[model samples]
Target: MTARPILLAAALLLGACSDAPSPHDLSEEAEYFEVSDNSNNTVPVAISLRPIKLDLEIPRHHLASIAHPYKPWAKTIWDRVNLQVLLPDFQFRNTQNLAEFNSQDSADVLRYRIGGLSSDQSFVLLSVNKEYQEVDDFADVHLRAYVNRRKYGNQSEESIQARQPTMFVVNESYLRTPSEKPIVLSCNLRRCNASMVIPASNWPEADRVDFGGTQGVRIEFNYDQKYLRQWQQIHNFVLATIASYIHYPESVL
Candidate 1:
Protein backbone atom coordinates (compact mmCIF):
# COMPACT_ATOMS: atom_id res chain seq x y z
CA MET A 1 0.00 0.00 0.00
CA THR A 2 1.35 3.48 -0.89
CA ALA A 3 0.23 4.85 2.45
CA ARG A 4 2.21 2.36 4.47
CA PRO A 5 5.56 4.08 4.08
CA ILE A 6 4.09 7.50 4.80
CA LEU A 7 2.12 6.22 7.78
CA LEU A 8 5.11 4.40 9.15
CA ALA A 9 7.36 7.41 8.76
CA ALA A 10 4.78 9.65 10.41
CA ALA A 11 4.28 7.12 13.18
CA LEU A 12 7.99 6.88 13.79
CA LEU A 13 8.35 10.63 13.89
CA LEU A 14 5.46 10.85 16.37
CA GLY A 15 6.60 7.87 18.45
CA ALA A 16 4.62 5.82 20.95
CA CYS A 17 4.13 6.86 24.54
CA SER A 18 5.90 4.83 27.23
CA ASP A 19 3.13 5.42 29.75
CA ALA A 20 0.27 4.31 27.54
CA PRO A 21 -2.29 2.05 29.16
CA SER A 22 -1.76 -1.71 29.10
CA PRO A 23 -3.82 -4.15 27.02
CA HIS A 24 -5.52 -5.53 30.13
CA ASP A 25 -6.68 -2.10 31.27
CA LEU A 26 -8.06 -1.13 27.85
CA SER A 27 -9.78 -4.55 27.43
CA GLU A 28 -12.31 -3.66 30.10
CA GLU A 29 -14.10 -1.70 27.40
CA ALA A 30 -15.44 -4.80 25.62
CA GLU A 31 -16.17 -2.84 22.48
CA TYR A 32 -12.50 -2.22 21.73
CA PHE A 33 -10.50 -5.40 22.37
CA GLU A 34 -11.27 -8.99 21.38
CA VAL A 35 -10.17 -12.04 23.39
CA SER A 36 -9.78 -14.98 21.05
CA ASP A 37 -7.25 -17.47 22.54
CA ASN A 38 -7.89 -17.88 26.26
CA SER A 39 -5.77 -21.02 26.45
CA ASN A 40 -2.59 -19.24 25.36
CA ASN A 41 -3.50 -16.02 27.21
CA THR A 42 -3.17 -14.00 24.05
CA VAL A 43 -5.14 -10.79 24.12
CA PRO A 44 -5.41 -8.63 21.00
CA VAL A 45 -5.58 -5.00 21.96
CA ALA A 46 -7.41 -2.21 20.12
CA ILE A 47 -5.75 1.13 20.64
CA SER A 48 -7.30 4.44 19.60
CA LEU A 49 -5.35 7.68 19.48
CA ARG A 50 -8.46 9.80 19.46
CA PRO A 51 -11.01 10.05 22.26
CA ILE A 52 -13.89 8.84 20.13
CA LYS A 53 -16.44 6.05 20.31
CA LEU A 54 -17.45 3.58 17.58
CA ASP A 55 -21.21 3.13 17.25
CA LEU A 56 -21.76 0.41 14.67
CA GLU A 57 -24.53 -2.16 14.84
CA ILE A 58 -23.25 -5.44 13.44
CA PRO A 59 -24.99 -8.78 13.48
CA ARG A 60 -23.46 -11.30 15.85
CA HIS A 61 -22.93 -13.74 12.97
CA HIS A 62 -21.33 -11.11 10.74
CA LEU A 63 -18.82 -10.13 13.41
CA ALA A 64 -15.58 -11.92 12.60
CA SER A 65 -14.14 -14.39 15.10
CA ILE A 66 -10.58 -14.11 13.84
CA ALA A 67 -8.94 -10.83 12.93
CA HIS A 68 -7.25 -10.28 9.58
CA PRO A 69 -3.72 -11.64 9.92
CA TYR A 70 -2.10 -8.46 8.61
CA LYS A 71 -1.86 -6.28 11.76
CA PRO A 72 -2.05 -8.98 14.46
CA TRP A 73 -3.50 -6.59 17.05
CA ALA A 74 -7.27 -6.31 16.88
CA LYS A 75 -10.01 -8.48 15.43
CA THR A 76 -12.01 -5.75 13.68
CA ILE A 77 -11.98 -1.97 13.68
CA TRP A 78 -15.31 -0.88 12.28
CA ASP A 79 -17.79 -3.75 12.04
CA ARG A 80 -18.72 -3.27 8.38
CA VAL A 81 -18.11 -0.17 6.34
CA ASN A 82 -20.46 -1.78 3.77
CA LEU A 83 -20.81 -0.47 0.25
CA GLN A 84 -23.63 -2.87 -0.62
CA VAL A 85 -25.94 -0.88 1.63
CA LEU A 86 -25.46 2.01 -0.79
CA LEU A 87 -25.16 -0.04 -4.04
CA PRO A 88 -26.24 -3.57 -4.77
CA ASP A 89 -23.52 -4.42 -7.30
CA PHE A 90 -20.89 -3.91 -4.62
CA GLN A 91 -20.93 -7.32 -2.92
CA PHE A 92 -18.08 -6.56 -0.57
CA ARG A 93 -17.31 -8.32 2.67
CA ASN A 94 -15.20 -6.74 5.45
CA THR A 95 -12.70 -9.03 7.19
CA GLN A 96 -13.04 -7.29 10.54
CA ASN A 97 -9.56 -8.43 11.60
CA LEU A 98 -7.15 -5.48 11.59
CA ALA A 99 -4.89 -3.51 13.92
CA GLU A 100 -4.97 -0.10 15.68
CA PHE A 101 -2.20 1.60 17.60
CA ASN A 102 -0.92 5.01 18.63
CA SER A 103 2.23 6.36 17.06
CA GLN A 104 4.72 8.57 18.88
CA ASP A 105 3.22 11.40 16.88
CA SER A 106 0.07 11.23 19.00
CA ALA A 107 -1.78 9.88 15.98
CA ASP A 108 -3.74 6.66 15.72
CA VAL A 109 -3.18 4.41 12.69
CA LEU A 110 -5.93 2.06 11.54
CA ARG A 111 -5.71 -0.46 8.68
CA TYR A 112 -8.37 -2.90 7.49
CA ARG A 113 -9.61 -4.81 4.41
CA ILE A 114 -12.99 -5.16 2.69
CA GLY A 115 -13.33 -7.34 -0.36
CA GLY A 116 -15.80 -9.15 -2.59
CA LEU A 117 -17.36 -12.19 -0.98
CA SER A 118 -18.16 -14.03 -4.19
CA SER A 119 -16.44 -14.14 -7.61
CA ASP A 120 -15.73 -10.48 -8.21
CA GLN A 121 -12.30 -9.14 -7.39
CA SER A 122 -13.61 -5.90 -5.88
CA PHE A 123 -12.39 -4.55 -2.57
CA VAL A 124 -11.69 -1.39 -0.54
CA LEU A 125 -8.71 -0.99 1.70
CA LEU A 126 -9.04 1.85 4.21
CA SER A 127 -6.62 3.73 6.42
CA VAL A 128 -7.45 6.33 9.05
CA ASN A 129 -4.98 8.58 10.84
CA LYS A 130 -5.32 11.26 13.48
CA GLU A 131 -3.33 14.40 12.76
CA TYR A 132 -2.27 17.20 15.09
CA GLN A 133 -2.54 19.86 12.41
CA GLU A 134 -4.60 20.41 9.27
CA VAL A 135 -4.37 17.30 7.04
CA ASP A 136 -5.08 19.15 3.78
CA ASP A 137 -1.55 20.48 3.57
CA PHE A 138 -0.17 16.99 4.13
CA ALA A 139 -2.37 15.51 1.38
CA ASP A 140 -1.69 18.33 -1.09
CA VAL A 141 2.07 18.02 -0.75
CA HIS A 142 1.94 14.28 -1.45
CA LEU A 143 -0.51 14.65 -4.34
CA ARG A 144 1.81 17.11 -6.02
CA ALA A 145 4.74 14.79 -5.40
CA TYR A 146 2.91 11.90 -7.08
CA VAL A 147 2.08 14.06 -10.10
CA ASN A 148 5.68 15.24 -10.42
CA ARG A 149 7.01 11.70 -10.18
CA ARG A 150 4.72 10.46 -12.95
CA LYS A 151 5.57 13.43 -15.13
CA TYR A 152 9.32 13.60 -14.55
CA GLY A 153 10.36 10.23 -13.15
CA ASN A 154 13.22 8.22 -14.69
CA GLN A 155 12.32 8.24 -18.38
CA SER A 156 13.72 9.57 -21.64
CA GLU A 157 12.45 12.98 -22.74
CA GLU A 158 10.87 11.46 -25.81
CA SER A 159 9.15 8.70 -23.82
CA ILE A 160 7.88 11.19 -21.22
CA GLN A 161 6.50 13.46 -23.94
CA ALA A 162 4.87 10.51 -25.72
CA ARG A 163 3.13 9.32 -22.55
CA GLN A 164 2.18 12.80 -21.37
CA PRO A 165 -1.36 12.57 -22.73
CA THR A 166 -2.01 9.26 -20.88
CA MET A 167 -0.27 10.18 -17.65
CA PHE A 168 -2.41 10.74 -14.56
CA VAL A 169 -2.94 14.34 -13.40
CA VAL A 170 -4.76 15.92 -10.50
CA ASN A 171 -8.53 16.39 -10.96
CA GLU A 172 -9.54 18.72 -8.14
CA SER A 173 -12.84 19.66 -9.78
CA TYR A 174 -14.08 16.14 -10.48
CA LEU A 175 -16.12 15.89 -7.28
CA ARG A 176 -18.31 18.53 -5.61
CA THR A 177 -18.07 19.17 -1.87
CA PRO A 178 -20.16 21.81 -0.15
CA SER A 179 -18.64 21.67 3.30
CA GLU A 180 -15.05 20.62 2.77
CA LYS A 181 -12.47 20.53 -0.02
CA PRO A 182 -12.88 17.98 -2.82
CA ILE A 183 -10.73 14.91 -2.25
CA VAL A 184 -7.30 15.00 -3.85
CA LEU A 185 -7.09 12.60 -6.80
CA SER A 186 -5.26 12.12 -10.10
CA CYS A 187 -6.69 9.97 -12.84
CA ASN A 188 -5.77 8.65 -16.27
CA LEU A 189 -8.07 6.59 -18.53
CA ARG A 190 -7.56 3.26 -16.75
CA ARG A 191 -7.24 4.26 -13.06
CA CYS A 192 -7.00 7.08 -10.54
CA ASN A 193 -4.56 7.59 -7.70
CA ALA A 194 -4.58 9.56 -4.47
CA SER A 195 -1.76 11.12 -2.51
CA MET A 196 -0.38 10.06 0.91
CA VAL A 197 -2.29 6.75 0.81
CA ILE A 198 -1.69 4.37 -2.08
CA PRO A 199 -3.92 1.35 -2.57
CA ALA A 200 -2.62 -1.82 -4.12
CA SER A 201 -2.44 -1.91 -7.93
CA ASN A 202 -5.30 -4.42 -8.01
CA TRP A 203 -7.53 -1.74 -6.50
CA PRO A 204 -6.55 1.18 -8.66
CA GLU A 205 -9.03 4.03 -8.25
CA ALA A 206 -8.43 5.85 -4.96
CA ASP A 207 -9.27 9.10 -3.13
CA ARG A 208 -8.68 10.68 0.28
CA VAL A 209 -10.29 13.36 2.44
CA ASP A 210 -9.41 15.38 5.51
CA PHE A 211 -12.22 16.23 7.89
CA GLY A 212 -10.47 19.51 8.42
CA GLY A 213 -10.06 21.82 11.46
CA THR A 214 -10.33 20.23 14.91
CA GLN A 215 -11.86 17.04 13.56
CA GLY A 216 -8.26 15.89 13.03
CA VAL A 217 -9.29 12.76 11.12
CA ARG A 218 -7.98 11.88 7.68
CA ILE A 219 -9.34 8.89 5.77
CA GLU A 220 -8.10 7.23 2.59
CA PHE A 221 -9.72 4.32 0.76
CA ASN A 222 -9.09 2.75 -2.64
CA TYR A 223 -11.34 0.45 -4.62
CA ASP A 224 -11.59 -1.36 -7.99
CA GLN A 225 -11.71 0.65 -11.21
CA LYS A 226 -15.13 -0.67 -12.23
CA TYR A 227 -16.77 1.54 -9.60
CA LEU A 228 -15.04 4.71 -10.73
CA ARG A 229 -18.30 6.26 -11.88
CA GLN A 230 -19.73 6.02 -8.40
CA TRP A 231 -16.71 7.59 -6.79
CA GLN A 232 -18.57 10.60 -5.43
CA GLN A 233 -21.39 8.57 -3.90
CA ILE A 234 -18.98 6.03 -2.56
CA HIS A 235 -16.87 8.75 -1.02
CA ASN A 236 -19.88 10.36 0.63
CA PHE A 237 -21.18 7.07 1.99
CA VAL A 238 -17.84 6.06 3.41
CA LEU A 239 -17.19 9.43 4.99
CA ALA A 240 -20.65 9.75 6.50
CA THR A 241 -20.82 6.18 7.75
CA ILE A 242 -17.45 6.38 9.42
CA ALA A 243 -18.02 9.86 10.81
CA SER A 244 -21.26 8.68 12.40
CA TYR A 245 -19.33 6.11 14.38
CA ILE A 246 -16.81 8.58 15.79
CA HIS A 247 -18.05 10.63 18.73
CA TYR A 248 -15.60 13.06 20.20
CA PRO A 249 -15.56 13.91 23.86
CA GLU A 250 -16.58 17.42 24.92
CA SER A 251 -13.00 18.39 25.64
CA VAL A 252 -11.86 17.50 22.14
CA LEU A 253 -14.80 19.34 20.62
Candidate 2:
Protein backbone atom coordinates (compact mmCIF):
# COMPACT_ATOMS: atom_id res chain seq x y z
CA MET A 1 0.00 0.00 0.00
CA THR A 2 2.83 2.38 -0.77
CA ALA A 3 1.45 5.60 -2.16
CA ARG A 4 2.16 8.17 0.50
CA PRO A 5 3.81 11.31 -0.86
CA ILE A 6 2.24 14.25 0.91
CA LEU A 7 5.63 15.64 1.92
CA LEU A 8 5.68 19.33 2.85
CA ALA A 9 7.62 22.13 4.66
CA ALA A 10 8.90 25.19 2.80
CA ALA A 11 8.74 29.01 2.43
CA LEU A 12 9.20 32.35 0.49
CA LEU A 13 8.66 36.15 1.02
CA LEU A 14 8.99 39.81 -0.15
CA GLY A 15 7.53 43.40 -0.37
CA ALA A 16 7.55 46.91 -2.05
CA CYS A 17 5.05 49.07 -3.93
CA SER A 18 4.12 51.36 -6.89
CA ASP A 19 7.43 50.81 -8.68
CA ALA A 20 4.86 50.48 -11.45
CA PRO A 21 5.59 46.75 -11.89
CA SER A 22 3.23 45.79 -9.11
CA PRO A 23 1.52 43.32 -11.37
CA HIS A 24 4.69 41.28 -10.88
CA ASP A 25 6.24 42.74 -14.04
CA LEU A 26 4.56 40.16 -16.19
CA SER A 27 6.85 38.72 -18.87
CA GLU A 28 6.87 36.00 -21.50
CA GLU A 29 9.27 34.86 -24.19
CA ALA A 30 11.56 32.42 -22.41
CA GLU A 31 11.51 29.93 -25.25
CA TYR A 32 14.66 27.75 -25.50
CA PHE A 33 13.99 24.90 -23.13
CA GLU A 34 15.90 21.73 -22.06
CA VAL A 35 15.71 20.38 -18.53
CA SER A 36 14.91 16.73 -18.84
CA ASP A 37 17.76 14.56 -17.50
CA ASN A 38 15.93 12.53 -14.84
CA SER A 39 19.35 12.16 -13.24
CA ASN A 40 20.91 8.63 -13.00
CA ASN A 41 23.94 10.31 -14.53
CA THR A 42 24.39 13.99 -15.32
CA VAL A 43 25.99 16.79 -13.33
CA PRO A 44 27.79 20.05 -14.08
CA VAL A 45 28.14 22.83 -11.56
CA ALA A 46 29.53 26.40 -11.23
CA ILE A 47 26.72 28.93 -11.18
CA SER A 48 26.87 32.51 -9.90
CA LEU A 49 25.22 35.79 -10.75
CA ARG A 50 24.85 39.21 -9.16
CA PRO A 51 21.70 41.30 -8.66
CA ILE A 52 20.16 41.58 -5.23
CA LYS A 53 16.85 43.07 -4.10
CA LEU A 54 14.82 42.28 -0.99
CA ASP A 55 12.43 44.25 1.14
CA LEU A 56 10.55 41.80 3.39
CA GLU A 57 8.63 43.07 6.38
CA ILE A 58 5.38 41.15 6.29
CA PRO A 59 4.13 41.47 9.85
CA ARG A 60 0.42 41.34 9.20
CA HIS A 61 0.39 39.19 12.31
CA HIS A 62 2.89 36.97 10.52
CA LEU A 63 0.19 35.91 8.09
CA ALA A 64 -0.71 33.15 10.52
CA SER A 65 -2.65 29.91 9.81
CA ILE A 66 0.32 27.75 8.74
CA ALA A 67 0.93 26.54 12.25
CA HIS A 68 2.40 23.06 12.80
CA PRO A 69 2.52 21.19 16.07
CA TYR A 70 3.17 17.70 14.78
CA LYS A 71 3.43 18.54 11.14
CA PRO A 72 0.19 17.80 9.36
CA TRP A 73 2.56 18.27 6.47
CA ALA A 74 2.30 21.96 7.24
CA LYS A 75 -1.43 21.94 7.45
CA THR A 76 -1.40 19.75 4.42
CA ILE A 77 0.75 22.26 2.60
CA TRP A 78 -1.54 24.96 3.83
CA ASP A 79 -4.62 23.34 2.44
CA ARG A 80 -3.15 22.99 -1.01
CA VAL A 81 -2.48 26.69 -1.35
CA ASN A 82 -4.10 28.73 -4.13
CA LEU A 83 -3.28 32.31 -3.04
CA GLN A 84 -6.08 33.77 -5.11
CA VAL A 85 -4.28 32.25 -8.04
CA LEU A 86 -0.84 33.45 -6.95
CA LEU A 87 -0.50 37.07 -5.68
CA PRO A 88 -1.41 39.19 -8.70
CA ASP A 89 1.67 38.11 -10.66
CA PHE A 90 4.26 39.27 -8.07
CA GLN A 91 5.67 42.49 -6.63
CA PHE A 92 4.77 44.25 -3.43
CA ARG A 93 5.38 47.01 -0.82
CA ASN A 94 2.66 48.59 1.23
CA THR A 95 2.92 47.73 4.90
CA GLN A 96 3.10 51.45 5.20
CA ASN A 97 5.84 51.55 2.62
CA LEU A 98 7.66 48.76 4.50
CA ALA A 99 9.97 51.15 6.26
CA GLU A 100 10.45 53.09 3.08
CA PHE A 101 10.97 49.82 1.29
CA ASN A 102 13.72 48.52 3.52
CA SER A 103 15.41 51.85 3.44
CA GLN A 104 15.54 51.63 -0.33
CA ASP A 105 16.93 48.09 -0.54
CA SER A 106 19.72 48.23 2.02
CA ALA A 107 18.18 48.45 5.41
CA ASP A 108 18.75 44.66 5.11
CA VAL A 109 18.49 41.92 2.51
CA LEU A 110 18.82 38.17 1.75
CA ARG A 111 17.76 36.40 -1.41
CA TYR A 112 18.90 33.03 -2.80
CA ARG A 113 19.16 30.52 -5.66
CA ILE A 114 21.96 28.16 -6.76
CA GLY A 115 20.83 25.18 -8.76
CA GLY A 116 23.09 23.86 -11.57
CA LEU A 117 23.42 22.08 -14.94
CA SER A 118 23.72 24.19 -18.07
CA SER A 119 25.55 24.24 -21.41
CA ASP A 120 24.94 24.42 -25.14
CA GLN A 121 23.97 28.05 -25.66
CA SER A 122 22.54 28.88 -22.26
CA PHE A 123 19.85 31.33 -21.17
CA VAL A 124 17.77 30.82 -18.03
CA LEU A 125 16.51 33.59 -15.80
CA LEU A 126 13.71 32.61 -13.47
CA SER A 127 12.22 34.64 -10.64
CA VAL A 128 9.57 33.67 -8.05
CA ASN A 129 9.36 36.14 -5.20
CA LYS A 130 6.19 37.93 -6.02
CA GLU A 131 5.79 38.19 -2.26
CA TYR A 132 5.09 35.94 0.75
CA GLN A 133 7.09 36.40 3.90
CA GLU A 134 5.29 37.96 6.77
CA VAL A 135 6.86 35.30 8.94
CA ASP A 136 5.74 33.96 12.29
CA ASP A 137 6.76 30.41 11.60
CA PHE A 138 6.92 28.98 8.10
CA ALA A 139 10.00 27.77 9.97
CA ASP A 140 11.29 31.29 10.07
CA VAL A 141 11.49 31.36 6.26
CA HIS A 142 15.03 30.78 5.00
CA LEU A 143 16.35 30.71 1.44
CA ARG A 144 19.25 29.46 -0.75
CA ALA A 145 16.81 28.18 -3.32
CA TYR A 146 19.00 26.41 -5.92
CA VAL A 147 22.19 24.43 -6.52
CA ASN A 148 22.40 20.70 -6.73
CA ARG A 149 24.96 19.04 -9.00
CA ARG A 150 26.65 15.77 -8.19
CA LYS A 151 29.11 16.07 -11.13
CA TYR A 152 29.00 16.52 -14.93
CA GLY A 153 29.51 19.51 -17.22
CA ASN A 154 31.09 20.94 -20.36
CA GLN A 155 28.68 19.09 -22.60
CA SER A 156 30.50 19.91 -25.81
CA GLU A 157 27.84 21.62 -27.93
CA GLU A 158 30.82 22.19 -30.22
CA SER A 159 31.41 25.76 -31.56
CA ILE A 160 31.84 28.17 -28.66
CA GLN A 161 29.38 28.05 -25.75
CA ALA A 162 31.19 27.79 -22.46
CA ARG A 163 29.84 29.19 -19.17
CA GLN A 164 27.22 26.84 -17.72
CA PRO A 165 26.50 26.74 -14.04
CA THR A 166 23.28 28.04 -12.46
CA MET A 167 23.94 29.74 -9.16
CA PHE A 168 21.64 31.96 -6.99
CA VAL A 169 21.81 33.29 -3.45
CA VAL A 170 21.00 36.60 -1.74
CA ASN A 171 21.61 37.47 1.88
CA GLU A 172 21.25 40.69 3.86
CA SER A 173 19.96 39.67 7.26
CA TYR A 174 21.22 42.58 9.26
CA LEU A 175 18.69 41.65 11.90
CA ARG A 176 15.71 39.26 11.96
CA THR A 177 18.19 36.37 11.92
CA PRO A 178 16.92 32.77 11.92
CA SER A 179 18.37 29.39 10.90
CA GLU A 180 19.73 27.09 13.51
CA LYS A 181 19.03 24.33 10.97
CA PRO A 182 16.12 23.21 8.77
CA ILE A 183 17.02 23.91 5.12
CA VAL A 184 17.69 20.41 3.91
CA LEU A 185 17.54 19.20 0.25
CA SER A 186 18.76 15.63 0.61
CA CYS A 187 17.25 12.92 -1.60
CA ASN A 188 18.98 11.86 -4.77
CA LEU A 189 16.91 8.70 -4.94
CA ARG A 190 14.00 8.85 -2.51
CA ARG A 191 13.20 8.62 1.24
CA CYS A 192 11.91 12.13 0.69
CA ASN A 193 13.55 15.15 2.32
CA ALA A 194 12.60 18.23 0.32
CA SER A 195 12.41 20.51 3.31
CA MET A 196 12.67 24.33 3.21
CA VAL A 197 10.67 25.74 6.08
CA ILE A 198 12.97 28.73 5.81
CA PRO A 199 16.15 28.14 7.84
CA ALA A 200 19.46 28.77 6.07
CA SER A 201 19.85 32.54 6.06
CA ASN A 202 23.60 32.63 5.47
CA TRP A 203 24.57 35.70 3.49
CA PRO A 204 28.30 35.61 4.16
CA GLU A 205 28.84 38.54 1.83
CA ALA A 206 27.35 36.35 -0.93
CA ASP A 207 30.75 34.62 -1.23
CA ARG A 208 31.78 37.01 -4.07
CA VAL A 209 33.53 36.42 -7.39
CA ASP A 210 31.15 37.61 -10.11
CA PHE A 211 32.97 38.67 -13.26
CA GLY A 212 29.58 40.18 -14.11
CA GLY A 213 27.85 40.03 -17.49
CA THR A 214 24.76 38.01 -18.44
CA GLN A 215 21.96 39.83 -16.69
CA GLY A 216 21.60 36.95 -14.18
CA VAL A 217 22.28 33.31 -15.13
CA ARG A 218 18.86 32.09 -13.98
CA ILE A 219 17.81 28.73 -15.49
CA GLU A 220 18.99 25.55 -17.23
CA PHE A 221 18.36 22.41 -15.27
CA ASN A 222 19.16 18.69 -14.83
CA TYR A 223 19.47 18.39 -11.06
CA ASP A 224 17.80 14.98 -10.93
CA GLN A 225 14.52 13.38 -9.73
CA LYS A 226 12.98 15.94 -11.99
CA TYR A 227 14.59 18.46 -9.69
CA LEU A 228 12.16 17.17 -7.11
CA ARG A 229 9.41 18.67 -9.18
CA GLN A 230 11.24 21.95 -8.74
CA TRP A 231 11.27 21.46 -5.01
CA GLN A 232 7.55 20.81 -4.97
CA GLN A 233 6.87 23.64 -7.31
CA ILE A 234 8.74 26.00 -5.05
CA HIS A 235 6.92 24.60 -2.07
CA ASN A 236 3.57 25.11 -3.61
CA PHE A 237 4.63 28.49 -4.89
CA VAL A 238 5.57 29.67 -1.45
CA LEU A 239 2.46 28.08 -0.09
CA ALA A 240 0.31 29.96 -2.47
CA THR A 241 2.32 33.02 -1.67
CA ILE A 242 1.55 32.81 2.01
CA ALA A 243 -2.00 31.99 1.18
CA SER A 244 -2.23 35.29 -0.62
CA TYR A 245 -1.46 37.31 2.42
CA ILE A 246 -3.36 34.94 4.64
CA HIS A 247 -6.66 35.25 2.90
CA TYR A 248 -6.37 38.93 2.39
CA PRO A 249 -9.60 40.86 2.82
CA GLU A 250 -8.82 43.78 5.04
CA SER A 251 -5.88 44.79 2.91
CA VAL A 252 -2.34 43.36 2.95
CA LEU A 253 -0.68 46.39 1.45
| Top candidate (TM-score) | 1
Candidate 1, which segments miss by more than 4 Å at Cα? 1-13, 18-50, 59-88, 94-154, 162-179, 186-214, 240-253
- Compared with the true structure, what per-residue lDDT tens digits does model 1 show for residues 135-224? 232233222212121334577856643432111222345543222233444345444433221122212122111111122222434443
Tens-digit per-residue lDDT, 53-159, candidate 2: 21222322222111111112111111111011112222233333345323533312111222111111221233323211112111223323332222246645342
TM-score for all models, in order of appearance: 0.36, 0.20
- What local distance difference test score does each model get? 0.29, 0.25
- Position 130, candidate 2: lDDT: 25
Question: Candidate 2 — what's its lDDT?
Answer: 0.25
- For residue 157, give model 1's deviation from the true position in Å: 2.1
Instruction: Output the number of the lDDT-best candidate.
Output: 1
